[model samples]
Target: MTSMKRVLKLCLGSARGAMVQGGALTVLVLLAGVGLLALSGWFITAAAAAGLAGAGLAFEVFRPSAGVRALALGRTGARYGERLLTHDATLKALVAVRLRLLRGLMSQPLRRLERARAGAALNRLIADVDALDGVTLRLFLPAVAGALTLLVSVIGLAVLVSGTVALWIGAVYGIGALGIGLRFGPQALPVARRAERALQAVRARTNDAFAARADLTVYNALDRQIAHAGHAATELAKARAHRDGIERAAQFWVTATVQLAVAGALGLGFMAVTNGALSAPLAMTGVLAALALSEALMPLARGISEFGRIADSARRVMGDIPETVPELHPRHDAKPMVVPPLDLRSVAIRPLIDTLSLTVEAGEMALLAGPSGVGKTTVLNVIAGLLPPDRGKVCIGGTPLTDHAEEDLRGRLGFVPQRTTVMDGTLMDSLRLGNATLTEAEAWHLLDIVQMAGFAKSRDGLQTRLGSRGNALSGGERRRVALARAIAGRPPVLLMDEPTEGLDEATATAVLKGIRAYLPKSAILIASHRACDRVLATRVITLR
Candidate 1:
């Protein structure tokens, strides 16, 4: 319950600004609706009492046009206000939720994150966060506003008319609408969950297919893969159809029940008029007021049904994120570390499933050479502060890496993983990931060192766009570009995994030479299996 409350609070905090605006608009609309209904009842009663005489006929002529204009203005204003506030809140909440997810992932160990698929993480970030947009804006606020409107309107109408009449009207409208929501709410949950799962599966499968497009084409299995995607999409549509059908059935029953209750009220009003207990105009007015009051509850019922679906999706999304990320805590008396430049005292890291310990010193380029699956990249991640050792202490400049601020520690080291993760941007944008303030001259100079100057020269220098995953450039060129990015910041320490994997002999040598020239003072650690590459290292630390 406490966790749920915390999540709600986080969501509300993001949307509070828009809630204020929406709440105000909701109040105005409720007032306008009540006023319109009351005034229309009074005017109709007056016209009936006058028996269509001269003044009565004139009153009827002006009242309807006046009511229509006022109602139109109120509805238009309310809708505009509601839309403005809801959209603003939706966007704000999405941003907050995304940031929270990112912060959570950042705190976890690299190996744990790797265990979670990339597509799953991406789905959580994009689709899961998007789920909350409807939750807060379309579902929560509107439902709350509608309920308030019904309550206030019912109380006001009771004061204007008989308590019994108001009670009958409120009960018929409110209970019917509430019943509709309750009946379909539970059924909607399964459908929503299945739909969300299907969407995630589709996303993951699509990503896998695209990543292995060449393999699929070579094996002539492209048609089969496409058919699989079609099936997933079909499943999603079926789930949606099922949920909608249930909701529609609920709405149908609720509407029928409300209509029967309204018919009963009108019959009672007519009998009262004939018996002289109520006037003819009063009877007609009472019937109209009851119908209008009942209609107002429809939006509330729809909002509740939508909210149920959002809640279901929210549960699934939150469950997908690992609950292990530590909450941020502030320190009062702790000062930043100020000591030796870099220090690693007997640091030993062994994988949870393996038995090996690797250690290195500052200002030394140690190459971890071993067969595949020996956790070479994992070892580098541990050293680069991207992963925490299971049973070892990681200290830099005499302070534990965990104790130091994450941003400060990250600034002290550079890491380029085996898989190239390039954002959708120009070459300069990619380079800026290393150091945002890297000057144009310095960028070109670094490119020259990596033998990429000619490529940049052929293009339009820093403005040249690089395709996704560095697809625009050759394999060796991509490796060099990544290398240049790693050393751009000239951090105190550098960690590289398979740095020369795709480079040709000449380009490989040039990349090695560039690392030596640019990072002459920084501690460089490269993990590779190439014997020729080991010759460029200051010291080789081989792993089994």
Candidate 2:
């Protein structure tokens, strides 16, 4: 709860001016509404009494009529302004939250990010971020606006009517609002929170179902996945219905409490009239004020009911962020280490790569050979700086790898992992990973080297849109595209993990031939368990 408050404070602090302005407008809108209703009731009663006394023409009706018009216009205009400012502030806060979330994720270790992708983390992240808007729009603003209306209405009644009568009215209305909060607020909170989780579950399952549609169909389990999504949706709907029922009941109780208060006021007004202590017009005004105050207080119950879920969402969003994020500003003084004989001196990774020492000199193609569990890929990761060595050091050009920033190292090394990662974008977009500024001509040249130029040009040229995870292309095609992307910038030291794993024999031979011809002067290290990879290597390092 404390953390939730902290997050709310941070959000409010980001757009304090707009929030405060919107809050002030809301107060004005509520006050205008109450004033309009009270004035209308008093005017009608006063007009009726004057007519009964045969003094209808002598009464001053124009002033009250004009006041009513002014209040109506003011309330409408203020309500519109409040919505505009509040929504604008919310949009700004949304942008801030997204930026912070991206920064937090980027600061985490590569392994953590990789693990997070296998679950529903992305769906939940989006849901939690959007839920924050409700906190500002529904909860905080409405609660504050309702309280202000109550306070001002009570004070006005006390001045217009008798103090004793005002006290009774305040007690009834205040107690009714407080009771609604105490009785239903806590109950609806947990239910609303459960609904949020249920909804997230439904969203996650739906996304998974779509992403794995082909596999599910092939395995004859498409119906099973669809059933799972349906079940999650049913649970979410049930939870929402329960939470809403509690809110409606609370609203009904508030309505009844206000009616009872109005009845009591009418009785008191009759006694005052009989005793010649209060005017009929003023008594009517007091009753109308109670009704207006009830309307203002109604939304408060809904806001309180929603408070718990938004708080829960806030907690989930901030839960994974480190206490302090690493600074991501580009380092002006850092540059990629030039020259190479990529060297790992006595490197040891827990349960893998035990006390390994190796060197891949410039212009040489080195192969990492081992059986299935010998950490061939792990060594490549360590050299690529994705995994920190438990002992010993990795150096390039006699400079320790750790001495260079991660961004700087990215330019000096080209690493293609075992898994293919191709997001939904145009062909040019995916091919520019190694170099953002690469021109279409240069990208096509690289694709031609990997024998994908004809394929890309025949489709949409540089504008070919790939589906999510490059699902539009086959396994071999995706692998070749990834290779083209990695070499687009002509990285001096290449690290590939089973680059030919998914390709046919002829395609794999052409890929190796292209690499040798295009990058003859660059050092290359390939991690593979395939015996066929040995023929292309200048030297093979066989792990025991």
TM-scores, in order shown?
Answer: 0.89, 0.87
lDDT computed for candidate 1: 0.71
Candidate 1 per-residue C-alpha lDDT over 1-544 given as tens digits, one digit per residue, 9 for 90 to 100? 2333444666788878777787668656765765666567766677766766556545555757688578869877897887787687768877877777887776666767879887777767886668667665555566677677767766865676555566777777777767777777677767777887777768767877898889999999988888888789889898878777776776777677668656865786777777787766656555666666554555544554565457765765565445554555544444574433344445556542244444445556778887888778877777677766666566656677778765665666778889867665787888888888999898888898888888988998888888877778877778788888888888777788988888776778778877877877676778898876888887777666
| Ten contiguous residues minimizing lDDT sum, candidate 2 | 117-126
Give the clashing pairs for model 1.
none
Q: How big is the positional error of residue 371 in model 1, measured in Å on the Cα after superposition?
A: 3.0
lDDT, residue 511, candidate 2? 85
RMSD of each: 3.3, 3.3
Worst 10 residues of 1 by lDDT: 351-360
**Candidate 2 lDDT by residue in tens digits, 1-544:** 6656656676797899999999999899988988999899999999999999999999998999999999999999999999999999988887777677777776667778778854456744576788788777887788788787778878888888877667877888778878877887778668877887788778788989998999999999999999999998999999988977887887788779989888888888878888999999998888888777776777766766676677777777777655565676656676556877788899998887669888889899999998888888888888988888999999887778988776667887898999868889988999887789999778888888888888887899889988988999888888888888888777788999999887777778778778878888788999986656678889999987
